[model samples]
Target: MRGSSGVAATFWSFLSISSSVLALEQQPFQFEAMSVPTYTLPPLPYAYDALEPHISAQIMELHHGKHHQTYITNLNAALKSQAEAVHAADITTQVALQQGIKFNAGGHINHSLFWQNLAPASSVDAKSSAAPKLLKQIQATWGDEAKFKEAFNAALLGIQGSGWGWLIKVETGKEQRLAIVTTKDQDPVVGKGEVPIFGVDMWEHAYYLQYLNGKAAYVQNIWNVINWKTAEERFLGTRADAFKVLKASI
Candidate 1:
């Protein structure tokens, strides 16, 4: 419904999917992108209908191309506008650009993670290994996996409007625990530096046709396609970064 042009959408989708990873020759911690991170619509890791029966091809195409690309376009525009306003010292324009930057960038970051977090159910190789780690963390925090899922689902369904239901690892505490958190309308999870290891998108565009109005079914089914290796890498990466400050002193 957003960038609905077929040519533009196809071009972006292809470019994103086929684009090779940018090699970073720089040192560690150099890529701390918070305010002006040049966000791009990451290409889906598989075919548009790769996860069919769970997510439809038509829906996937529209969601990735139209919806996701619009956010990236708007975010880049906001960044350029912000730079100009800062140079010209235009307070009014500067104030207006702030909201757009955060909203659009948040949308980009959120969807980037969302795409990587999924795959065809048949493609998952480490589900058994990574699932129990998440479960143990969940149960330790919530007392049981069922209760953890219920709370997680409640957080998802309780979104009055559009937002995200996140299972964030609160690394600040002594033990690793999964916290059910909600954010309103494309809010950034790491703007203040708290890392988000997992997120469940509650937006209608995320799960409308497949499960219809069955939010619970959709939430339950999301576990099937999770790329646990990627998730574990993200978890260890974040923890390694955060605890680095502590480890340095010790």
Candidate 2:
């Protein structure tokens, strides 16, 4: 299996190429070589105060601007430092940078996705609230939506310390299933080959400003801002991609 640093390098390389292509395409006739792309903190889809009572503006600012930016910065530094070692096939240097790369890359990936996972309660339409397809899958897997929420919350509450609670889609042979899993620190769910359709950060920094020590309250209230529409889109898109891959393989 590829180590964390390898994964981080591959992910950033793809991002770099895509960005370079877009930059070149935007220009009329200027020919300029694209430099290596540095990972950046993606802007939140909504305003800082959008989540409001459920997630305070102060928390959003600190979480997105400060915390997430730190990860992006560190990730870029780690990748840059290890680039030559990685190209030289030096496993020792790669291993030494693995943890830092994983932590920062995972933080960047998770926080980027987390921002999209939320929306103002009012802005979420009835269709988003319904999540008909996801609801059926939830019902089939966990009996009902309420039961799924209960189980998911229980999983979040069970975290011994800083971690994340993720609702992921996994494929087993011909069958696709939904699973609730947790990852410690900033580790991402995608590392396990599962697509994270929804995730809630269980770290204190995510809620300490507003809920204090009440992790349960934070977890419960986060449901109010969850973008079910985004979750459904991820779920269905992953499934569709997997199907296309399977067909191509055949």
Candidate 3:
């Protein structure tokens, strides 16, 4: 067990040093009254080597530690002064901080979904039972799961550059309506008043190394591990008052 797979060691290095935010973690916040939860990447419940073949070990390590953690680090820093500025009623200060929070926070949230959205492609069973209720919703709304997958994959692949493809629930008439949304960069789905049930990461770093130039192959493989159960929970379950979803136990 002690043979240094270079996997665990590299992961720690990426988390502790390579990540942008972890370094700033020591810088104490000047104001403590800010009502924002400091954004951070939740530790994945599985191992780096878990999602291979379809996605390489190198990509997972970099995506989780360096890319995801950086978002959390930057978001926390942005929130540090927000409390003081808001308390003092400084219009300009509060306004300026909005863009930073949205971008970095979006990065944090989107990455979280990105991680959850993937699994070892091997786990995919094309004939698995689809929850009756979930299936009914899909057929009525998007014709069928196959069609939905096609649309989802197409949208995700179409993102001009770094961003996300989302299956969101929009509010209308008294119930949440199902809709597909493509968020550019790290923008939050909630900001646009859509509740994101599932999301696909389309960033170059998300697939470039593993798939190389094979974008369609990457997209096809992602659906194999789509966490249908989690998607149901996000859709039917309740989320926190302000941007909080009780961490889904893996």
lDDT of each: 0.67, 0.78, 0.68
How do these models rank on TM-score, best leading? 2, 3, 1
Per-residue lDDT, model 3, residue 5, is 36
Give the TM-score comparing model 2 with the true structure, all chains together.
0.81
- What tens digits encode model 3's per-residue C-alpha lDDT throughout 1-250? 1123334544554464444444345444643422444655788756887777667789889998998888878888888777668767887999999999899878887777656555555554222243345556777898988898888888887888778888876655457667888988888787444667778788888889888888889889877666665565455543321133213211
- The TM-score measured for candidate 1 stands at 0.74
Q: Tens digit of lDDT per residue, candidate 1, span 1-250?
A: 1123434544554465343233222322453332343555666888899867677788789888988899988988898788668656799999988889889878877777777667787874437366545556666778986787688778888898889977676655444445678998899577333656667788888888777788778777776766665555455445333222212221
Better of 2 and 3 by TM-score: 2
lDDT at position 87, candidate 3 = 63
Clash pairs, candidate 1, are: none
In candidate 3, list every pair of residues with a backbone clash.
21-73
RMSD of each: 11.6, 8.6, 10.8
Best by TM-score: 2
Least well predicted 10-residue stretch by lDDT in candidate 1: 241-250
TM-score of each: 0.74, 0.81, 0.76
